[model samples]
Target: MQVSDYTIGIDFGSDSVRALIVDVTTGEEIATGVSYYPRWKKQQYCDAAANRFRQHPLDYTESMTDAVRQAVAEAPDGVADRVIALAVDTTGSTPVAVDESGTPLALLDRFSENPNAMFVLWKDHTAIGEAAEINAACRAAVTDYTKYEGGIYSSEWFWAKALHVMRDDDAVAKAAYSWVEHCDWIPFLLSGGAQVKNMKRSRCAAGHKALWHPEWGGLPPEEFLTGLDPVLAGMRDRLFDETYTSDEVAGNLTGEWADRLGLPAGIPISVGAFDAHMGAVGGEIEPFHLSKVMGTSTCDMLVVPAGHEGAGAQVKGICGQVDGSVIPGMMGMEAGQSAFGDVYAWFARLVAWPLENVLAKNTSLDEATRTKLIEETRSAIIPQLSEAAEALPISDDILALDWFNGRRTPDADQSLKGAIMGLNLGSDAPRVFRALVESTCYGARRIVERFIEEGIPVEGLIGLGGVAKKSPFIMQTMADVMDRPIRIARSEQTCALGAAMFAAVSAGKYSDVSAAMEKMGGGFDAEYQPDAKRAAVYEGLYQRYLRLGEAIEKETHEDRDDAAAPKPDKRSVAEPSESELL
Candidate 1:
């Protein structure tokens, strides 16, 4: 009998941490455990109105400990003893300020409650101004630092968020020695790394979010950074130059972490990476097949052979194209929408306002009944809305823009806002919801079009994550809008599974990621083909969406110009104008 080796994959998401144990021989998932972040569940250290989202380091440590131990306990007896290695995937560029010892500032007593000292969530947009300045500075510089990063830097990325916090918080800025991405920091913590400088940075995180490129010798020059802002003077030096792929071993698990996870000590741990990148691999990604991780946001990944034609093309307005970021020896390209499933969630919340506000205030019903009613309604909103929206006719009478969280791809512009047009009293909830759904699909199509226009063909799409698996309505709509078929991965936790595959490779259970993927991949379970009639109708509606988007974008720029224009002196405005004087 061939003995089996097991590996664990830990995925750190925005709200929770999950641990997935897999049998390497058969790619069978043995056990899974999940733990939500307590502080984050209560909405701590976040300001939605200001677009600031922070996560405490304790939340990560506590939740990870709970999740891993739970998974170990749930597995068949002695399976935990057979576990060979572990890997991790996390959202990025979720980075936090760290001291020289590689400890997150939030872990220290004085900075424990400071939001600026915590890990800045990927969706946070507090650094819009800082991002713009970086873009401007890059454009004016001798070397364009953002060329590989789609020629645009986003507020959601590392430098912009770091600069924003440094400028905003004096205590954090003064005490911080360096910044570390959530993906990089987690592995270092598990491996018991001693110093910030010794942490092995992820190529995916560095290339995609931190503007680290080999062309300019990894990270923009110190002179360039200081020129952008004096606060960023020594940042380049404090950060790393070399980066490692997820398949490589970062280090061995320390005795402390091994005890906490209930696993053997000194087992190899693979380098960490972003969730979507690893999720693509778990979904059995192929050359030219776009892997769309459709969660709160959509991260679309495409891997092409390193020697493929146009592989060296610098596709504009994408997230980034990094060598070995997804699969080693392949050119991994990324693009995404800042809002995907979040669009539906936002609409549901908007529609549920009266129920939560008014019904909760009513004294007519008991507290228990009211609570149950609210919970049921909130849960049913999306499914109910989806069904009704599916029944509505496809038309361009109403259109919406999927920029509620700002545009993230085909040109990242966080300043843009979402809008719905042609709405009247007659337009009902279902109708509005339908338009919103179509808007997201249209946004997706735009990304596909951008890739094609840039000479990178998207042969098909592999869908993974909550929106892809749960909502057939949205998936079908996406197919119709793109006029292409969509394949949904079989695994519920593709991100975690991908991490396990990497862990297997690092532990010598497999020679490389491709071999591990071939052995462990969960094939497609469902496929959505574009309906002929709907596809044709959506073609016209999609054009309307583009027109509306153009108008909105133009208006947005004009508004910004108006805002930036120096206000006319009050005295001068009150007095006669030049024409009147003449």
Candidate 2:
């Protein structure tokens, strides 16, 4: 394939969609476009939130139109008709309630206020109770179905959210039809003509999230389904069908879709796959190398040449393990941190700095102006905080866990709450900030430990995503926590690049994902090797984090009042100068 005959890779994320144009021969990105999701974050249980995190399906359409148009338009002058194949990867477990016609329920006025009308975004944790029931029931099933999920099924996946909607809103139960992922539906929208016999199932999505397995013929028994929610048990056919992997062409873009997007009809389009998995393909990292897409939350994906064994693992507390889920001949192990950069965002809000602006939060500092005074205080205070954090006699009382947004790995429970210990007048933001940072690293460590315990050797981490790209301190800390070197993938948009790789394969320009990845996917951008000294220091601190974490999980499980106070104060000052954080 010549460079002129390119492929387009569209990546649909939680908050936005990005499309990229790339040279098939050299794996070079030619031009790209990004468009944000129209609906912003939805606060839980608000007036408009009927237990739903809703978004208009139109937002996806608008972004898709703008991104694809610009991506093709911007590619070197003559690259329009040269496009061959298109592939898409999106945020996982993000399901939408669409009618038989493939439109989101939120578009209908009567369903506007109903939360079920909106997409049950991956971050929504309101289904924890329902997830617990599913896990409990899945635990009793016979087929060894839960192994694909690492052993436990998270509420964030398909089943729990569906059950929650059924129980929370009668309108959703009666009015809506198929529970479709945005990944599959977007392609369906573009294909226009006689839709595939069923867009209802995607092997990549269903196998990973919905418990639709191959050997069992489909989803687990109706008895297992009824145990979670009778409604779900009965809608088996509606909820699932034969699943297909990402490599399969779900369908072609019909004439209407082709003209709308300015592409040719019948141009091959691959089945939609999860972003994190595709991202691994993008980063050129393969099995055993954990690809951590650290965004609002962290998605950890590991591919194993062989599948796992854990029949009873789907119970709520057990993390799941799926087989033939990612690569055709390989088993894909997936898990996530319910929150990561979101934790930092929470802290940024506390400091009153707009998140994402690492620079220019402050221009200069002056004592009388207060901004200067605070900046200096913070400057002097951070090192002091670091030293104090290291040297100060931290009280046995000082403690905290990283569950502010809930857990998503190893054990998939979300009813858990966050807690803190050891706070006094002296307790301040720097200390608290450092603690929060450590809590996240320790959380990563816990998951790594779980894999190790299961005899799964994680060779190294191919870290790519917002957190890995931006933070050095956190990376170093993670190295210390994981006791392994961290290799940060070079591509800023590895997910987008991964999609491009898929595009190459779909175009027949490349043979398979592995070969395509090696030729096209750029590898590690930076590597953080384990520092024995730092790792040793982190050892002592990590033990403390564990003690605190255990206390929080235990108390939260008991639903007891959390008397443990978290540190909240920061030096009195205008926001610290941006450069100081660096």
Candidate 3:
């Protein structure tokens, strides 16, 4: 009798790490476990005001080991021995400075307490100045380094963050020999780790963030780096020129990691990629269908055949379009909002402020009772608000701009701020919450419109991640706003499933990613279709959102020459008014 084969998919998310043990034959998820980073859970080494978020290497190493061990232990006896392959997906552009031996500087005793030596998270925007400098330098160069990177170098990407951290700390700069993305470093750690020059790198992160384009023959020439900053001089050569896609095997797990994970020592480990890209694979994304990994932020993914509509199409203001980034033989396009669930999280905190600070201060109740009340109320705030907001009729007077973390698409700009307009005394918490949700939906619409305008087709939307799975109202709102059907992936852990699919291929279970996906792909959990009446009403509200955003941006950049014409009235003539709709 033949033994069954198994593979493990590990996903390193913003706040936690998850591991899924999957059967290769049927793609059934046998067991899963999640481990939150203790340090990150306590909000250590992060400065929200400075836009700096750093994760220590130990957090990743410990979490990966714990999550995998727990997940495997939950499976049937001998299943761990049957595990054939492993793959990982992580938040991208999250790069950490490492020494010559591929060890993150944060793990070194000398730099253990230094935040600059840790992994700079994708959401970190402290490198705005460095990003701007790169953009300006690229614009002036004979060959623009940003031509493939949406013509704009964002502060959220790899090079900018690395440069900023290096320039900020002389000690870190002197000790750091190279930088490694979170996705790449995790796999290397499992593969018995090698020198920085020999460790494998991911094409997804390199092409999207490091500007490693085929046209440039790899990373931009050393001249471009030297021109941008002498600090970056000769650094490109230290980084590997070759990058691997998700399907390839990075290496077999070494004895150390194998013992720690309680798995076989020689199990194959597939190359790593960003969560959104792998989530696209897990969602069974087809050509032209948009895949959205909606979490703290939203990473919108679109993959098309290289010869299809995306061939040579310069999608203006997208994150980046890279070959083999998602699938082996396709062009993967990325775009996202800098804030999505983060917007809701911020509002939830705002609503809970009185319960903790003011209401709890009135200690008529015992301390424990007050604390319990505050905790319960804090947990229920968003759900109650969503429930209330869902019942309320649409109102044009409630409007907002979803730029709390600045814009990430249709031209990357980090200097913007979020705004809530038309908030008079009548604006209740639910009303304001509804407007914020609408603003996020509107933001999604803008990205879709931009893609369509650029001749890149978005047939329909596929939703992944916590927001897509847990929040029905958010998905429904997105459907109504886009006037399109939204399909939610059936698997709760789609990114991990996607990683497992890649593991299947790397373990030689399937010929390629497509075949593995066909066998193990998670189908739609639910489909949210647009309500004609609600969509029609949202059409007008979307227009108001546009005008409101334009006005805010114009006011913010008053000195710009191409300021938008005078804003239009909030009321729309073509659409029904709030009273009429009600």
Give the candidate number with the greatest TM-score.
Answer: 1
Q: What would the per-residue lDDT of candidate 2 be over residues 352-423, giving only the tens digit for each residue?
A: 443214333445533355554555554453344445454443333455677877788768767665666677
Of the two candidates 1 and 2, the one with more favorable TM-score, higher being better, is: 1
**2-56: candidate 1 lDDT, tens digit per residue:** 7788999999988899999999988999999999999999989999999999999
TM-score ranking from best candidate downward:
1, 3, 2
lDDT of 1: 0.94
Each model's TM-score?
0.98, 0.84, 0.94
Worst 10 residues of 3 by lDDT: 559-568
Better of 1 and 2 by lDDT: 1
Per-residue lDDT tens digits for candidate 3, residues 476-538, read 999999999999999999999999999999999999999999999869879999999999999
Stretches of candidate 1 off by over 4 Å are 573-582
Q: Give candidate 3 misplaced runs (Cα > 4 Å).
A: 359-368, 559-582
Q: How close is candidate 2 to the true structure, as a TM-score?
A: 0.84
Q: How close is candidate 1 to the true structure, as a TM-score?
A: 0.98
Model 2, C-alpha of 101: deviation from truth (Å): 2.8
Q: Which parts of model 2 have CA positions greater than 4 angstroms off? A: 1-3, 41-52, 140-147, 193-197, 307-319, 353-399, 560-582
